[model samples]
Target: MKLYTEDPERILIYGGSRKDSGEIRGIISGDTLKGSFYYSSYGGGTLKRYPVAMLKRENKWLLGKGVISIYMGIPSYLKTEPIDYSDPKFIFEEVKK
Candidate 1:
């Protein structure tokens, strides 16, 4: 799938960390969003990737938003990545298929 991260400025995590580009990646899943990413600590051993939600948020990353919260909190050390907003290639191939 071809997912594009929302405008970094518009897409803020817990505090307001301006996310970087390329943090975005695309993948395909079932009825719901699904994927995995790495959460790293200062220590090398702490670096490990795990499954994360591939959903969308109404405003910003918040637990109340469910999957969407997963979409917006890419830099929260949760190691989440922003889901692509919209695109024929991404929507048709990735989301809808």
Candidate 2:
């Protein structure tokens, strides 16, 4: 899964062999993002084991929680490339591990 954002709190998630998409919108409170999303592969599978992960070249981790749910097997709201703060390689490894 890959996560990027136009805005810090507004997120876009790309996941799975189907390459489905999802969105997470909310504010970053403490160490978590309290939001809701669609097609988020990490919502409940392997990736979900780690609710948060450190962003790439950044000193912070994006925490996901609250009503931050997801919709699968569908497309996201927008189809633009967002900022990829989280480390893709690390995330992939985290999920696989």
Candidate topping lDDT: 2
Alpha-carbon deviation at 17 in model 1, angstroms = 13
lDDT by residue (tens digit), candidate 2, 1-97: 4445534332334443434234444456554343334443433343221123233224434431222222473322222434343434434212221
Point out where model 2 deviates above 4 Å: 6-16, 40-97
Q: Please report, in order, the local distance difference test score of every candidate based on alpha carbons.
A: 0.33, 0.36
> How does candidate 2 fare on TM-score?
0.31
Colliding residue pairs in candidate 2: 35-68, 38-71, 39-71, 56-85
Candidate that scores best on TM-score = 2
Q: Estimate each model's TM-score.
A: 0.28, 0.31
| Cα shift from native, residue 57, model 2 (Å) | 12
